[model samples]
Target chain A: DAGITQSPRYKITETGRQVTLMCHQTWSHSYMFWYRQDLGHGLRLIYYSAAADITDKGEVPDGYVVSRSKTENFPLTLESATRSQTSVYFCASSATGTNTEAFFGQGTRLTVV
Target chain B: GESVGLHLPTLSVQEGDNSIINCAYSNSASDYFIWYKQESGKGPQFIIDIRSNMDKRQGQRVTVLLNKTVKHLSLQIAATQPGDSAVYFCAPRQAGFQKLVFGTGTRLLVSP
Candidate 1:
């Protein structure tokens, strides 16, 4: 209850629909990241926020959007969910990006139909 | 993301035997490397990390080796146990950057 948490451990959504995955951390970490895990592809970063108001795109940012209005919360949104967008989503936080090990939350298994 | 890759996707080892997982990274800018273990239905958990300046680092039952010359890294587990059966991933991060590139994990199976 003191670490990071993700909402909707599992989700099933229709294509072209909008979906948002929630992430919250209690440590008030300076960095928050969203990664999607797919078979044979490993974990790909979709978006990351350095602080409360800064966010940037990673490798795969096509259908994903992320915002960090608060230091404790960073939410990822799929503007138009596609079938290929289905994957296990992980939210992680770290005190800094230099050498600090990130703490990950329980992933959200999302399937787009 | 940058490519962080492992040699094998699956490994089967007898319980009590030592296990080694290998990873290769291509980014010369990466300054930190870490190994993570992901149990079924869970996110990747940090196991150990070694900076670019260090050649090796050890944890409780695991050791990580970093070869900046060849841009490779490895994780070795001593006395592998059934509880160690999980997917292991290696991630390399650039200095002062928050985005970490994760390698395709190696599934380690410890058979009793």
Candidate 2:
């Protein structure tokens, strides 16, 4: 009952449609991250937030937007979904920067048709 | 030379046997590393971690070995069980950043 959780564990949308994936953590971790997993690429960070209102782009942030309005919530949005955006999205939270354990949510599988 | 990779993409071992998964990293500046286990349709869970200052770290039935000399890292599971079947990824923590670069991942299949 006290862990990270992602909304709509699965999503399906058509191309050019907007989609938002929600991530929530109960631990109130300061560091929250969004990553996309595709075949051949283990996990690519899309965006991360150090704290409320503080966000930064990761390796592959194009076509994606993220906001951290609260310490427990970080949401990722795809302005316009594309087939390439179809992948498993993972949300993780850490207490600090280095030498900290990251807790992950169940993940959301998005499909863009 | 700051990439993390694995020698094998998949490994199959009989249940109750030991399993060794290998990983190689190129960043000498990376001081921390972690091993994550991800089951199908789920997010990766942290299994174990090790820092550059140490060569080995153990947790429960898992052990992580870090060889900074060759930029290699390994995870060994003793008496592997069916529950251990999952995709294991090795991630090396960047020196001055919170971002972790993950390896391709090794799929471990345990046979009963």
Superposed model 2: Cα runs more than 4 Å off: none
- The candidate maximizing DockQ is 1
Complex DockQ per candidate = 0.88, 0.76
Tens-digit lDDT string for candidate 2 (B1-112)? 4688899999999999999999999888999999999999889999999989999999888999998899999999999999999999999987777878888899999999
- The Cα local distance difference test for each model comes to 0.93, 0.93
Error of 2 at A59 (Å): 0.8
Model 1 global lDDT (CA atoms, 0 to 1) = 0.93
lDDT of 2 by residue, A76-103 (tens): 9999999999999999999886698788
Candidate 2 clash pair list: none
Error of 1 at B87 (Å): 0.6
For model 1, the stretches where C-alpha displacement exceeds 4 angstroms are: none
Query: In model 2, how large is the Cα lDDT of residue B11?
Result: 99
Tell me the TM-score of each prediction against the true structure. 0.97, 0.97
